[model samples]
Target: ELKVEQNPLFLSMQEGKNYTIYCNYSTTSDRLYWYRQDPGKSLESLFVLLSNGAVKQEGRLMASLDTKARLSTLHITAAVHDLSATYFCAVVDAGNMLTFGGGTRLMVKP
Candidate 1:
């Protein structure tokens, strides 16, 4: 079975601050993805890290993958109210199914 875990399940930040969210998974897979979701909404794809050392950035958010360690990271830069949301990292199994992390909820207060 695959398991994904995220740290600092809840975060409160001030505007213009930065923080990093960590995701760790059990098992081996090079396919990992990051997503964002708003309250009472579906997830929006943020980054798709297909291999080790793969990194992608959009706006104030960045994501990276390290297949070797079965780890992924989502970095938030210059937090803003609009950026407050839940972030998730998922790992794909051989069957192409994903095991998602518990999710990290970020609240940016101005």
Candidate 2:
């Protein structure tokens, strides 16, 4: 089984819209992180999912954690073209190695 994976590798989104991205893992983990990257740009922090029921938001994005099921989620609300970017969710295993999801690329239209 894949340690970490995200669905819909590419997302064609719209301005002033809302969407949800899901991340799944094979085993239980405590540390989860959500990061954003724009085209030709470096990574930026959006939220960090640490434990069960942990939720955080910034700007138009929010993230949640569910350690029991080894799942995390990033939810985007009222997206704008400026929100166009790539989103990644990562989880740290027992060995302290961060395992990254395949990533979701979002393209918001004007």
Maximum-lDDT candidate: 1
* lDDT of prediction 2: 0.85
TM-score of each: 0.97, 0.92
lDDT of 2 by residue, 1-110 (tens): 33899977999987988999999999878788888888788878777777799999888888888888777888889998888789998888888888889889999998
Report every candidate's CA lDDT.
0.92, 0.85
Worst 10 residues of 2 by lDDT: 42-51
What are the runs in model 2 whose C-alpha is more than 4 Å off? none
The 10 consecutive residues of candidate 1 with the worst lDDT sum are 62-71
